[model samples]
Target: MQNKTRYFIILLILVPVCFSADILLGSTHIPFSIFVDMLRGIEIDETWRIIITELRLPRAIVAVFVGIALPISGLLMQTFFRNPLADPYVLGISTGASLGVALFSLGGGLGMVAIISNFGFASSWGLIIAACLGALMVMLLVVTIAPKVYDTTSLLIIGIMLGSVTSAVVSVLQFFSNPNELHAFLMWTFGSFSGLGWTEIIIMACFIVPLLIISFTMQKPLNALLLGENYAQGLGVRISLLRFQIIIVASLLAGVVTAFTGPIGFIGIAVPHIARMVFKTTNHKTLIAASILIGCNLLLLCDMISQLPGFQSSLPINTVTAMFGAPIVIFVILKGRKSRLHYS
Candidate 1:
């Protein structure tokens, strides 16, 4: 308890520092004094004002929410399937979003994709709507089938298969696409926290905040689930309802993040383990809180790194995250294997 409290306090301190770093250390440097003056509502150089207010500020906000949304979605999946490997991507939600984007971007101006892609603000809305619909379609399919499946492993396999199918469809779209459209679609897959304005951020918050609140409320049932479905049911928990809720919440969180930011990979799979190792407990209350802070800080750090401080060129957000996150995931898998081998 003391350790958790201490870590929580440290996280509170680091979050603001990281957030400030995100805004301050970008392609164009904004000096501390100038930034402070700008924040205080004083007029500043036009270029600096636009960069700080329009670009960096919105990007940092999106990073915070993306960080929060993905890890929580991951924690829910890990709990839901009782599998450490389970993540937002594992269930094909992001792949579904990718398919939606592909169809919209490279569907050759067909039907709704053509109409929606033609509008300015509506183009973004079209992508969001298409991604959500694709994700919900998969979620509904999984929900219907999950009840009949006796093993979580089988369900995990089903999700992988679905993702594989979606990927193939995307590949076909890319193959047929012209180079210009293909380049655009490729960049979206690389993931970014930039280019999101206030409107998109608000739309994301509407989905993520309510789902996060509901997830926090499910702590008891989630804790119950850790012991197995039979045990959970024995304790009078409604396993079916709880499973349904978890799916909906996880889907919405993952879906929305993917819609806006593209599919951010390893953070969803890696950050929960970081939380577990740091807090040294499976308790959802602590895990969820720690995951939120750690995830946010880590992504902010990634965003800062992606800016490539010494160079004018910026790296893709997904590239930076995967570089850090993939190693953590590999370490966890190897550690788990060694432990199982020792016990066996």
Candidate 2:
């Protein structure tokens, strides 16, 4: 409890600092004094004001929410599956979004883009809508199949197979795609927070905030689930209803973020482990909160790094996250193995 309290305090301080750094330390350097002045309602240079308000601020806000949504979704997956390796993408949600983008980008002259554009989302919004539909399709399939399978391991394997099939389809699309279209799709895969504007951020928040509230309300049931479904049911938890809610929440959290930001890997898998290692508890009440903070801080840090000081161009957010996240996952796997051997 004391450790959890300390972690919370540390996160309270660090998250804001990270967010401020994200706003101030982008490719275009804005001095702290200038930012402070802007905050105080003083007129600033037009370029700097636009840069701060239009670009960096929205990017940082997206980073914060993406961080919160992905990690919490991952934590729920890991707990629900009772597998250390389960993540938001483990069930092919990201692949579904990718497929949607692929269809839009590579389906040249297919009139899909034209059809979507006719509805007034010809820009990034169209891509986002397509991605959401793809993700929803996969989630619906998983939810439909989940009831038939008594064990989570089977469901886990099914998700992997679905992802593999989706990837194959995407590969086929890529092979036939025009170079310019392929490039566009590839760039989207790189993942970015900067592309989101205030309107997009508001839409993302509408999905994320309500889902987060729903997730928080399931804390007791989630904790019960960590022990196994049988054990959770023994505690009077309704396993089927709980499972349904978790899948829905996790799917929306991951699917919406992927739709907006492209597919961000590793954060979902790694951030939860980081929180667990720090707080040393499986209690969803604590883990969920800790994951939210740790996830936000980590992504903000990644966003700062990707900005590449002194350069006008930024690195892909996915690249920065994977570089950090992959090693952490390896460490977790090895540690888990070692602990299992020791116990045996």
Which is the leading candidate under TM-score?
Answer: 2
lDDT tens digits, residue span 180-286, model 2: 77777888899988767888988999999999999999999998887789999999999999999999999999999999888999999999999888988888899
- Cα lDDT, all candidates: 0.86, 0.89
TM-score of 2: 0.95
- Model 1 sits at a Cα RMSD from the real structure of 2.3
lDDT of 1 at 102: 84
> After superposition, which runs of candidate 2 have C-alpha atoms over 4 Å from their true positions?
109-123, 341-344
lDDT of 1 by residue, 183-233 (tens): 878888898888888898888899888988999999998999988989999
Q: For every model shown, what is its TM-score relative to the native structure?
A: 0.94, 0.95
Let me know the TM-score candidate 1 reaches against the reference structure: 0.94
Lowest lDDT 10-residue stretch of candidate 2: 114-123
Candidate 1 weakest ten by summed lDDT: 114-123
- Residue 207, model 2, lDDT: 98
